[model samples]
Target: MYKVRMRFSKKDFMIFISHLDLARVMERALRRADVPLCFTQGFNPHPKISFATALALGVSSDGEYVDIEIEEKIDLNILKEKINKELPEGIHIIQCQYIDVKSKPLMAVIEYSTYIVRCVLADDVNEDKLNALIKDFMKNKEIIIHKIVKKKNKTREKEINIRPFIRNLELLNKEDCNCIFKMTLATGSKGNLKPEVLIEQLKDRMKISILLDSIRVHRLGLYSIKDERLIEPLEIGR
Candidate 1:
């Protein structure tokens, strides 16, 4: 089998679709495109596709990745064109490239994700104060947040210190109660941090109220360490 890595974008209405539904949509599109997708050998076989990470509900991403195993090698350009033609609006293929079959799956290799968060702040919140708050927040060695996890079918809230998981968080721009932030956080099998959780902590610490719906998060990209440098999914195994 030939392994092909594809980068795509999730935006607009597609951002609300669940990960399972997105998988179904991709499967349907692949079938319609007539790509020779490889399937597992079993009574109930499924498409051989794996996602880098699942974008949270209502979140958008500019760089989402999936690896597909095909029965035979096909032209990357042709493959990209075929898939894009079948995909619905708000989802489009950005690029495609082949990778080593023995390379680790995207989910296992991804280490960090950068996000651009845009939100409206309360009018009373001053820009300078917000900047100072961010500085102080990062200075703390521990920023604890409660996370709900299901263990043995029992759901409970667990307090976790997320400071170590946060690589960088900066206030990018603020104007007239509107603000934007850039965040780089841990993501992968080792650890994961959601951008919203960080936002919630900031909101409370800043003593400001932000509409839950007004907060919009768009993932810039996912990265893995290669030769001591961060690289995209397509460059991971190379």
Candidate 2:
């Protein structure tokens, strides 16, 4: 079996699409593009396509990934061109390459994800106070948040410390009422932290009155931990 790895971007209205729907869209696009995809042996066969991670709805990402198994190897450039023509707006294939099917899957190797968050502050908001709160939040050893967990069809509150998952956090820029922050958080199977959850905790701890709708989050990239350093997914085995 030949494996093809694709790097794509999700923006505009496509960010609102659920992961399941996105998978369907991709399968349809590949069929329309006449790409040679392999199918399972069953009464109802399906294209062998898989995504690295399911991006949250309403969040935009530049470093999305998808892997597909094909019956034969195809020219990367030609494959990208054909698929791009069939894909809809806001869903663009950035890169495509042949990879070893034995290589670790993208989701299994993902360790962290970086994001840019921009929060529009109110006119009365104090920048100094916000900055102080951020500093204090980072200095704390444990920032616990109660998460609702469902077990055996019953829901219960479990306190989870999210501090360990946050690798980096900084206020990148602030101009008037717009504050921009760059954050790196644990992701994938190890542990996953959403930018929205971090912001919510910050707002609550800082006593900031910013509305949830005022915050905009964009995922910058995803990385894998190698020798205590962050490396891109594609660079894992290379």
Candidate 3:
């Protein structure tokens, strides 16, 4: 079997596609494109395709990663081209490469993601005030928030300190009431902090109001920490 890693983009209308549906879509597209897909061994066999992480609903990203095990080796360029042709609009393979099957899974190595968020500031708020608030927010040793977790089919809220998961946050641009910001936060198995969690913290801790309808999140890229540096998922094999 051959292990292949692919980086793809999901945006436009595809942002609404849930992670499970997205997987099904990819399986269908690969079948249509005639890719030689490996199947799991069981009574109900399915393609051996695994995503690095699940993007939040309504969030768009251009740096999603997936691992696929195929029956035989194929040219990376041809594989990308073939998959692109079969993919729906708003979804496209950006990069592809072969990796050793023994390498750690993408979900285990991917550590952080950078995001570009756009939202409308409340009528009473402005750039300077928001910036000041953010400055103070970052100085806290711990930013605690209530998180909902499900266990044994029971759901409950738990208190967690999300400050460590937040690597960086800053204001990028502000035009009239529209504002844009960038953030880098922890992701994957170690500690996953969704962008929405930080947004809610900002609102609650800072006592600020934002236009709910105007909030939008677009993931810029995903990265893994290696040798004390951040690198794209495709660089893992190298």
Candidate 4:
């Protein structure tokens, strides 16, 4: 048996697809690619594959990741070739290799993620002055806001202190009134900060009129948590 790490991207029309549907599609693609995947010995056998963070709906990514188990050792290059050949246009296999990751879980190791949010302002966007406010806000020890506690279809009223999850937010580049925001997301037991909530806080407090033609978030890299510190997930084993 072998443990394999496969990094792929979700883009194009596939971004509109839900994570569950993506999982199902990839499973079929692997089969077509002739991957010697390991399966649980149950009444119904299924490929042993796991996804880190399920991208929220309507988001595109160039750095999404998923891990799978294989029954036999295969050449990494061939595996990549076969998978890429079979994978649909939107999903592409960026990397694939065997690793000593038997005990580690992909979802558990993910500590922080980076995303690029595409937004257009409703007005001239006084970004020079607005950026200063964002910088100062990130420095504060405590920032509180009301959050919807999702129970099912309905979300309850609640107050969430964003200090725990948000590590940083920066405006990378802007063109023609469209702004690109790179944000780091929280992972593990500390929970995660949804992008919509952050945007809400910005609108309510920072007074930025961000209209979304599209919002794209990519899981840049996964990290392992240690003693309240962050480390790369691949450090578990090369």
Give one clash count per candidate, in the order shown: 0, 0, 0, 0
lDDT of model number 3: 0.90
| TM-score, structure 3 vs. true | 0.92
Model 3 lDDT per residue over 1-238, tens place: 9889999999999999999999999998899989999999989998889898899989999999999999988998999999999999999999998988888888988999999988886775777998999999999999988879999999999999999999899999988878788999999888988887788788788886767677899999999988868899888874
**For candidate 4, what is the lDDT?**
0.76
lDDT of 1 by residue, 1-238 (tens): 9999999999999999999999999989999999999999889999899998889998888889999999988998999999999999999999998999999999999999999999986554777888898889889898878879999999999999988888889989988888899999999988899998888988887666666568989999999876767789988765
Candidate 1: regions farther than 4 A off: 153-156
Give candidate 4's error at residue 32 in angstroms.
Answer: 1.2
If both were scored by TM-score, which would come out higher, candidate 2 or candidate 3? 2
Report how far residue 124 has shifted in candidate 2, in Å.
5.2
Q: Give candidate 3 regions above 4 Å deviation.
A: 124-126, 150-156
> lDDT rank, highest first?
3, 1, 2, 4
Task: Candidate 4: list runs displaced more than 4 Å.
Answer: 150-156, 212-219, 225-232
lDDT-better candidate, 2 vs 3: 3
TM-score of each: 0.93, 0.93, 0.92, 0.88
| Alpha-carbon RMSD, each predicted model | 1.7, 1.7, 1.8, 2.6
